[model samples]
Target: MDEANRSDPPKWIQQHAVYQDLMHLDVGDSAQVYAFFLVYMDLTEGEEIAAVVGVSCPELQAVLLEGREKEGEPVQMIYPLPSHRSIKHRELRSILDRGAPMLLCAVASDSSLVYQTV
Candidate 1:
């Protein structure tokens, strides 16, 4: 695995109680969890920009890929996920800025993915 390709979840997600439990119990490695769901806060536009990157679900990946394909950008940034869904930094920032926070939720069958940050 390329060290540069290893991405970590956003700090807010890392500080969440559910995330803490997972880390404490060693339920999964950081890299593996990241492969499924990625969340981050971008503080570039004088405020916090939060985004949730989901690649574990095939349906979502297809939707995003199809959308990107229609947009004329055939290629996207590849991540460590099995499906190979891509998300570039600039695109991520755009998603974070225009995308709503609720869209960041993990869209998967795992009940554990649902959690309240408080």
Candidate 2:
């Protein structure tokens, strides 16, 4: 098969696959996400923010981010989710709004065409 058309491994089987597999893996647009916040986010320790947060996408998407963190929003470290964000969806965003933090593994908020494609 052509490189882009090659079948990918099952998502569950590769959850903890090494980085090498990740490099070779090609997830489709559905698996792409706009951005990732962070992996181990824990906001229960006080009015504190994290040091790292990340945003990522598949090969393509039209997702956009809005609004600056409200006054004094804590900064956090961010890194790509290392996996195709096939699991995240509109529901995840709702969860975030409800103050439930998540380790969003996959999302495609950027692609305006995402709803149609799905």
Candidate 3:
């Protein structure tokens, strides 16, 4: 597999201070919460992504919990697959598509947000 096709965490995840901190968190749930926020950023676009950044931890937790209870908005659908198999195929395609842009956003420990596109 090419470098982009490798099934490994992206380089930004390895280098980001906030992501590093989240990984080191003793509470597994806390780490998952923050991870979900990172995923949320990736799936969101334009103003929605901006709106979610810098939210307090408690607010982030609430949004994550709420998402689990309901279907996500249509705009948030990253793929059109109706089955798990097709979704997995699309995910693999996404991983291999090196030219595709990935957005990385970090919420610092102090609750400040920064965004970068790669």
Give per-residue CA lDDT, model 1, range 37-89, as digits (tens). Answer: 33221211223322222222232232121012123333232222222233456
Candidate 1 least-lDDT 10 residues? 61-70
How well is each residue in 1-118 modelled by candidate 2, as lDDT tens digits? 1225434434653463332233343333323221212112222122233333222232223121222123456332222232333335664454344342333233223322211111
lDDT of 3: 0.35
TM-score for predicted model 3 compared with the true structure: 0.28
* TM-scores, each model vs. reference: 0.27, 0.19, 0.28
Distance from true location, Cα of 72 in model 2, Å: 2.1
Error of 1 at 98 (Å): 40
Pick by lDDT: 1 or 3, better one: 3
Ranking by lDDT: 3, 1, 2
Candidate models: Cα lDDT each: 0.33, 0.30, 0.35
Winner of 1 and 2 under TM-score: 1
Please give, for residues 63-82, the per-residue lDDT of candidate 3 as tens digits. 12111112443211111111
lDDT of 2 at 113: 23
